[model samples]
Target: MCVEEQWLTPQGIVIGTLLGIVLHVRFSPDDQQVAVCAGNKIYMLSAKNEAILAELDGHLAPVTAAEFCTWEKSMLISVSEDRTFKARKL
Candidate 1:
């Protein structure tokens, strides 16, 4: 979704809550990125800046879990309330 928005704390630390009500979060295999599941979509974010990089929309219900593929950092696996599981390429 490319939120391009940042949330700053009083101490000047930035925490990204852009995805809104994130149900799950997992680091990439290399720990260089993060995958977040919010609503029915999955958001790919930069680990360093928490910048949204891509949005994947395929689930019909709220996503319940998300994890990066162990062998492929660009591949993400997700489960949803829709009773389905899916994989997306980042």
Candidate 2:
């Protein structure tokens, strides 16, 4: 599950997972957002406040790796066991 606690205290707001177990996570250059690769889908979330922003769906198998592009601030690259590599715009 990708649930995130809102506060430091034990009693805090929690956000639930979107899909399968997260295998890898990468943060954008600005650090305002993060990308998570779980199962066969990739999810973008707010780094300041862990909230889902967008979902990327295409990979047929579990996503293995994910990284933010240095040259392109708006692009994210991911590789999967499906023998495929994809570049998506953030």
Q: Which candidate ranks first by lDDT, i.e. highest?
A: 2
Taking all chains together, the TM-score of candidate 1 against the true structure is 0.78
Whole-model lDDT for model 2 versus the true structure? 0.82
* Residue-wise C-alpha lDDT for candidate 1, range 59-87, written one tens digit per residue: 99999999778787678889999999998
lDDT of 2 by residue, 22-74 (tens): 89888788988878888998888887665889989899999999988899989
Single out the weakest 10-residue window by summed lDDT for candidate 1: 1-10
Worst 10 residues of 2 by lDDT: 7-16
Question: Stretches of candidate 1 above 4 Å error?
Answer: 1-15
Q: Local error of candidate 1 at 38, Å?
A: 0.9
- Model 2 misplaced stretches (Cα beyond 4 Å): 1-18
lDDT of every predicted structure (CA atoms) = 0.80, 0.82
- Cα RMSDs, all models: 7.4, 5.8
